[model samples]
Every structure is written in structure tokens, then in C-alpha cells.
Target: MADSDMGELAPSSSMDRRDPDLYIEDGNIVLSAKDNENNTVYFRVHKSTLVKNSPEAFGNMFSVPTPPNMDQYDGVPLVQMPDDAKSLRDFLTILYDPQCIATILKAEDFPKMLRPVELARKYQVDWICKLVASQLQSSWPDSLFQWNIVAREEGDIRAWDAYRTEAPEGDMDEPRGLRCLPEPVSSIILARQCDVPAILPVAFLHLLRFPSEIYDYNEVFPWQIPERSLLSQQDWARLVLARERITRWFTQEGPQPWKDCGTSGMQCQVITLTTWLNIAQEVAVDGNILKLYGRQVKGDICDKCKQKLEDRFYHLSVQFFRNLKHFFQLDE
Candidate 1:
């Protein structure tokens, strides 16, 4: 939609089209990318607007002298971009409306943020990159306190689902089964791409909870098979090894009661062993040892025995969580 008399983009060239919203009438530059059908879609936008926001990327790009015989559209210089039109549109939408960042962020789910973050990094948009990265890290459980809160929240979600399902038809609330948990494979890759290694251990732990058989058996080409996983061979191998280690821990260390448990009466000792077995079996099947911490396990045990169990659970959860780095064979 140029200011000139060109009523439609490529009136002659049917293979091309102009983005209705992005093709500003008086814009001085043109951006182009091939759509799925291999047709070039052109966007006319202001160069100064882009440069003003992403100085490092646009400044360097435009600062260079225009090459001889550069592509032109409606007398303005054309610059072909590598990104698809939709993603580029999203980038411009976020870049143009800095004041509406919170609104934009809230509307976007965690996985959807990946595109903007990727585009931000590619275009050297510092503030946008940092903003998205900080948001992603916050959504994940970074510390034990945060992890404990997540555990509680998930428990509540389960309870909520149960309540809605079991309630009378007249009392049933609106349908609610939304879980905003991040996609583990993409989250891990995004962390590596954005250099946020702190979230990796938890992400890896979440991925490990899923049976490897859910994905392709040919682990050698994990990254190539996007339908399965995008992890490199080394990362996949590390997870495989960690699964064995975790299972071994559940069988061995996880069931053992506190060192001083037997010193109590015979009933206390028997109850401790029974409680330990129940917790270990539950975690082993679910592959979520994190339940041991923060949530009190109800059983018929004395206060002293309860304290001992809590202490044991706390220590066990801490050990497994903190050692996640070693389990996944990640470098500190």
C-alpha cells in the first residue's frame, strides 16, 4: 500500500503480495521474506523506527553503504529478511508498542515467548531479550522455596480437577483443565539458546518424568526428530544415564529411614519402615521425589517419629534436587 498509484502489490507478479497491515503507505524501506509457497511477501516500514529500537542490529546493517544494484520497490531500497512474515510481524508488533509490554506478555503463553526471544536475540534487541528471558526463568522453579510452591500449586490443580468432576451437575463450574507447564524439550533448548542454565536441571528433571518410550526409540537422532525430542545425542545420553541413577536411588537410598529411627520403640521402628516404603514407591512410580518436602504425609506416627520422617524427607528431596546437575551430567 504505497503512497504512489500502485493500487495493489505486484498487480502483474501474482506470486508476490504486500502485507496489508505492515505495508505503511509512506514508509521508506521494504522488508521481504519468502512465504511457504516460495512467494516473496513485502512489508513497507520505516527504517528509522526499526533502527531506533534495535540500534545494534539495524545500525550496523544500515550503516554500510548500499550495494550496487540493490533491490528496490516503489523507489525505496528493499532488504530481504531471513524470518517468516508472521514471526517478523510479531517482532514488529512487540517492538512498536513498548508501553504495552505487560499486556503483550500476559497474552502470550510461555512457549509462544520463544519466538520473540529468538527474534530479539537475532536482531540484538537487548531489552526485549532480557525481558523475555527473565519472564521464562520466573515461571520455572529456580530455588527450593519456589519448587515447594510449585508442588503445592500442582497439588491444588489436581484437587480442583477432582472437585469439578465429582460435584453435582448443577454445582459444576466452568470446564477447567488448563496447565501452563512449559514444554520440557523446547524449554531446555531455549535455556541453552538464551544462556539461562539455572533452569536446565529442573527442565531436565521434568523431561525425565516422561517415559523414554513416549518418544522415538532411535535416540541417536533425537534432535532431528522434532516430533519426539530436540535434544542432542549427548544430552539424550545424559538423560538416559540419569534415569538409571534416579531409579537406583529410589530402590536404595530413598527407602531408608533416618539413622536414629530404631533407637525409638518397636512400634515407631515398624511405622517408620512402613511410611518410608510408601513414599519411596509413590515417588518411584511417578518419578517425582519432590513430594517429600513441604507437604506433610499423614500417618499414625508419634511426634518424634513425624519429625524424623520430615527431616529425612527434607534431606532426601534436597539431595536429589541439588544433585540434578550431576545426574544430568551437566557442567557446573
Candidate 2:
């Protein structure tokens, strides 16, 4: 038959018409079209039929769901453990297993895991504690004693002697702890170590000192401060003075690269100033007592009633009293 005529034949008729040498192999229809030329044509069953009819055929192929690409997920792709809590837990686990401490310490950017270091100290992981203390001493010579206290408190005593040995002499009475520890780190330590209330004021002070460090100010100190805890007028004035001092310092110092220091750093200073201003306004009361004096001096004339002078203080102060009452209600 002509080559074009082959198209007219049904698949089964064409298969039967092929040379007797034609056969099926591995589920594929293989037909020898020309003996001397060794020309052959092969066709496989439809993919849908193969999957439906033969379980063995599908077994060779993996059917896993595709994993999502890095961009598909949110936030930082690296630094695998999520947030401070997970990082702390993982760090504590590693510290408890001494064998892992050396490996973790050697990792790149190891200091970024300071939370874990603090956690290790808290949990009393000896090896991790020593490693942290050693690293801190080498990196922050000034903070060695402070870090030692951290280590000691955390129960890592192996490096306590090393801490003492390396402690700088002179002014031993002076506190030598981590002066530059960030507010978040300080708050974490306080929450872990001390009562929340005692530490709260300190934490709030830290927030005031380093407003940029706190991400959620509303969460930390809700907008509606308790009436009883509100600063007294005098204290509010003092806070305003302190804010002015900080602002003056910043103004004189010519704006200390606050913008480059990151949002938390900048916000810390802002929150302190803003909070002081807010509290000052909240407590300030206008003490001016309004007086209505008629052209004719009559001490007994009822200021509000304007009828005649009366002996009652209310009568003398009636106009001022009514105004005061209105002011108080508006203030509330």
C-alpha cells in the first residue's frame, strides 16, 4: 500500500496487516515496517489507560506533591527557627546536650542567637554557659563580669572561675554587668528572673530609653493607663523636664544618626518623649479661678445669682463654681 494510504486503515487492521515479525514489547506496539531496511514503528498505549490498567507501570514514577519554593513562604527564608521562643527552645535543647554546644558555637553568625545563650545560662547548661562566657569575654571585654553574672544566674558555673580570673581589677565595687544589653534582652532576662511588676517599671524605663526597641508599645503599655497609676502632676512635670533635656541633647548633638539605627531604636526615644508629654497633659489642671467683679464694689452680691450678697461660700463663688463644674465635666 502507498505510504499515504496507511492513514485510511483502522489501528487494529493496520496492526494485523504488519509483518508477522511485528509484536508487542513492554506494553508498546512495535511493528517492523520494512524487513531489509530494519525500519520499525512503535506506539504506546495512552497514558491514562496505562495508569488505570497497570499498577506496576505507575510504581516506577514518584507521585510526591511538589514542595513550595522559598519565595512562596513568608518572612526570612533562613534562620530556620521561628521567632524568639522557638530559637530559645532549640538553644536550650542543644545546651542540655553538651555534644551540640561546640557545633552550635562554631556556626556562622553564632552571636545572633544571644537569646539561646541567655536561655542556656538560665537552664544551667555548663558547657554552653562556658562557651557563651568565653565568647562574651573575648568580644566584649568590658561586659565579662556582667556576662558572668548572667552565666552564674543561668547555672553555668564551669566558666564562673574563668570569669573571675579574667575579671578586670580596680573599681570592683562598681557594677560590671552587661550595660549595653538591648532592652528586649534585658526584659527577657527580667521576665525570666524577677517578678513582672518589679521588672515592669524597669522594662518601661528601657522602652522609654530605647523606644525603637519595642515593636508593640500599645501591647506593652495600653493607651488607656490606669487612673490610680497615672503619674502625679509633680511627677508629670518632672517627666516633661526630662523629655526636654533629652530633646535638647539631641538638638545640640545635631541629630545622632537615629535614622540609621533601625526603627526600634528610634521609636524607643520617641515613645519616652511622647509618653511624658501625654502624661503631663493628662495630670495638668488649670488653677485659675474666674472672678466677675461689678463696677460697684459690693462684697455681698451673689456672683452667679446676681441678686444680693449672701454669707454662703457657694453664693460668693457661685459664678466661678458653676464654671468649675462645667470644666470638670468636660475634662472627664
Candidate 3:
């Protein structure tokens, strides 16, 4: 049947009904009221008309129960629709109906469906994650399986390394943080904490590796190093070079101005350390070492040195794992 024809027969009372207690006033549906001898007669105009014309008012008026005569009724609590219940009903109804389900199943626009799936994947609840997984399993099983395997393996490696390094010396009995959880679990934790879309692979990499290096390398690097340890020596060296390049960029052009001085030397040092720590944390969390290090000092000269801080500083910092390593070593 045609959509309009199908719409005509739908069971929505508001769609079929007319405004009963309202009248047209200046082309607008408005409530009509009369003051009786000792009471107020309050009645709505064409409620359905109001609903169609002024949905906000229509929603407000019929939202609760009232005495038969509007005049007889004193002010009372407005009727309210239970949003959660309505949502549950709508979801279940749409999900269970064969026609609706089939229509969704036949939809060729995968990207449109991707939005909701991504939302479900980001939901904090485990059941929601499972529901998303199940949907993916039924619709795009292969991709879902691949994501699961990769996420799980990566999650496991991260968890093991984190446990070995960050887990307190005598506190093995405590529950693991999100880092040690399954990928989906870790993703949910991160999504909840950060309030973002489903954690992409790159984002996962950043979260797992970069931020720790920024904050306290001695504490976080040991865990990340294990993942690098598996790489061939050549690959490791290349990775180090890439990291150096990024670190140089971050120091030079990153949001924090390294040259700015607060009132006290200690305060300046604290601010610098804290800023670098935060940058490192973000880089680690995103799992993109290159991004963490990619930021370069912005202007031509180090505001302090007046001489151009050469691009070579980028590689040098990586070699020493310190900012402005060349200047400091020369000073010493």
C-alpha cells in the first residue's frame, strides 16, 4: 500500500482527532474559558487541531488527567508521558515488526546504519555492547569478528603489560583497570570516561601508549615498550626516529609555550612539566606516538635562544627522550 494510505489507517489517536476545546483565534488555535457564577469553565479547543498546529501546547494540555468540566477542576499536576517507557515501546515495536525489520535489513545505506551501531558500541552498558555485537554478527559478521579479534588481542597485550608494570607491587588481587579489560570493555570504559564516539583503532592506540609517556614515562613507558619489544630492531629504530620527529614538533608548536615564565622558577618548571605530562598522556591514550611528537616549535627562533632551534632538535630529543636535549647537554 502507498505510504499516505498506510498512514491514514495508522492507530495514532492524535492524528485522527480534532481540537475539541479550542477555537480559531487570529488563525491560531487557543484555549477557550468562561467564568461561571462561582467556578471557571475551562475547556480546550480542537485538541487534535492544536496538536497539529501547536504541538507544544497540545502536548502540554493532554499530558495529564483533568476533571470532566475544565471549570470545576482546580490546578493539578500536568499529565506527563513516560519518555523511557515510550522509547522502550517504540524500539521494541519497531524491532519486532517483520515489515520494519525487513525494511532495515534491506537498506543499502550501510553508513546510515553505522551511526546507530557506532552509538551502541560506545554505550557504557555491557548489554548494549553485546546487542551491538549481535547486530553486527547478524549483519556484517566478518567485520565484527575481525574487530573483536584485533581489539581482544590488542587489549590482552595492553592488559598484560599494564599489569606487569603499573599494577602495584603487592596488589595483584585488585580488579584490572579498563586497560586490562577486553577491547570492548575497555572501549566502553573510555567512551564513558571521555564521552566520545566508538573508539577507533587509531584512538585506541593513542590511549594505550602516548599519554603515559607524556605524564610519567618511567611509570607508563615500561608497559608500552613491551609492544615495541616485539618489533624487529630496524622497525624499532625507525619507530624511534618517527617518535623523535613528533616530539620535536610537539615541543615547538604544541599548545603549551615552553618559553613562558611564571612568577617563580619552580612555578615555571611545574607548569612546563605538567603541560608536557598532559601532552604525553593524550598522545599515549590515542596510541599515536607520531602525533604526540609531531608538534613543532612555532616561530623561527627559540624565544630564549634567539637562534633558530633547528629541525635536528626533533631527532636529538628522541635520542635522549628529553626536550631541548642538545642545549641541556651542552650546558652541563
Tell me, by lDDT, which candidate is best.
1
The CA lDDT at 278 in model 3 is: 68
The lDDT values for all models are: 0.70, 0.33, 0.35
lDDT of 3: 0.35
- lDDT of candidate 2 at residue 26, scale 0 to 100: 33
**lDDT (10s digit) by residue, model 3, range 87-149:** 322232332242543454343222223333333333222333344333333332123234344
The better candidate by TM-score, 1 or 3, is 1
Off by over 4 Å in 3: 1-173, 176-178, 181-234, 254-332
Off by over 4 Å in 2: 1-88, 95-100, 107-112, 141-332
Q: Model 2, poorest ten-residue lDDT window? A: 71-80
Steric overlap count per candidate:
0, 13, 43
Could you give candidate 1's per-residue lDDT for residues 1-332 as a string of tens digits? 33234322333357888887888889988998777777778888998989998898998888999865566787778887999877787777677677555664554344555667778889888887677567668767877777777565556666656676678877855444433345677667677777788888888877766555554423221221232345788887877787777767866874344445434566666776787777666655546777678657565667777787778789988988888787777865
TM-score of each predicted structure versus truth: 0.77, 0.19, 0.21
* C-alpha root-mean-square deviation, candidate 1: 6.4
* Model 3 RMSD vs true structure: 21.8
Task: For model 1, name the residue pairs that clash.
Answer: none
Evaluated at residue 148, the lDDT of candidate 1 is 78
